[model samples]
Target: MTSKFYEDTKVIVKDKLFEHGWGILKDLYLGETPLASIAQKSFETATGTKLATVYLLDLFKENIVAIHGEYQSQATNVLSTCNVFIKENSTANEVSNCVDDFLKNANHYIDESFSRRLFLKYGY
Candidate 1:
């Protein structure tokens, strides 16, 4: 990802995670999140991608499992995979591989803290 996009993604992620910040993503990186985002732990979009699954819920911070995982895109496969991942998923490392892939995609400016935790598993 380019530095501009990386910076944008960082701002978006932080705003979504912070209290009284200015972000409004419904769920964590929901959709494809750019295969690259999951692959390397970041995203690159001059604007936005249809596959990107980021949205805001509210202004106040909320607790949610970081849903950024790799799985088949189809609904059936996705549902089944989600069941398996949620049931089998353990600590933050469960998604580190995915995150590593996300960074490898080459987002030029990832916030130093973006990949610190697995998804949104950190305490609020």
Candidate 2:
């Protein structure tokens, strides 16, 4: 998939899994979780194509499992930045812009990581 499409699919799958409380399960452990099924369905729905189960699982691992910690770190950084802006009495617009920029960067990071992992694993 193209980077843009993969990134969009990641957002959809992430939202769907989170809606089903996948984050809590992820924090606990891994292996045959229902989130995999949810992720597969979400991907098919978003992309109009059904990938093999193994491929789907790999995609899930790359998109969610592998990057969970980094995602959390980015989230923390954005929150800290917002807090700093608040403490400095920065304008609301400044805080909003910071958050927007962080989100854009975070999405780029996810896309880049996903592409890198796929290339390393499959040599695409």
Candidate 3:
């Protein structure tokens, strides 16, 4: 069964990351830019804030790890695929393709009986 929370989080993260444009998307997947930076940028862009609080940053970091763990649990091949994209000198198109495949194969379900988490932790 698909999880509404997981699906919602996925859409939210993707939309936020792509909000300004697709310019940073490749940088993120390539490891040239960190997800934290993107998260902060997204927050600032959405809220017009000059700075994000440490609490928000910590929450984002924690939820990001939790979300990754959930994704890994749902798709066993996710880490290996991500490793390939990150560790290898893959072209932009190759990385995009790999990410697309990974997303396509992921099972968007959460163990709802346990902690119900979202990537950003709070809505923008």
- List per-prediction Cα lDDT, in the order shown: 0.28, 0.32, 0.29
Cα RMSDs of all predictions? 16.3, 15.6, 15.0
In model 3, the clashing pairs are none
- 1-113, model 2: which lDDT tens digit per residue? 22332334334445543553344223111553323222221112121322211111223323321122122222232122221111123344543453344345544443344
Q: Lowest-lDDT window of 10 residues in candidate 1?
A: 78-87
How accurate locally is residue 122 in candidate 2, as Cα lDDT from 0 to 100?
62
CA lDDT, candidate 3, residue 48: 32
lDDT of 1 by residue, 1-124 (tens): 1233233343434443233222233333436342223211123222221132222122112222233432222232221222111112233343334333332331222211233222233422
Model 3 agreement with the true structure over 15-102: per-residue lDDT tens digits: 5334433222221323532332222221122223222111001133223212221122232322232211221233445434544543
TM-score (all chains, Cα) for each model: 0.20, 0.28, 0.26
Q: Report the candidate with higher lDDT, 2 versus 3.
A: 2
Compared with the true structure, model 2 gives a TM-score of 0.28
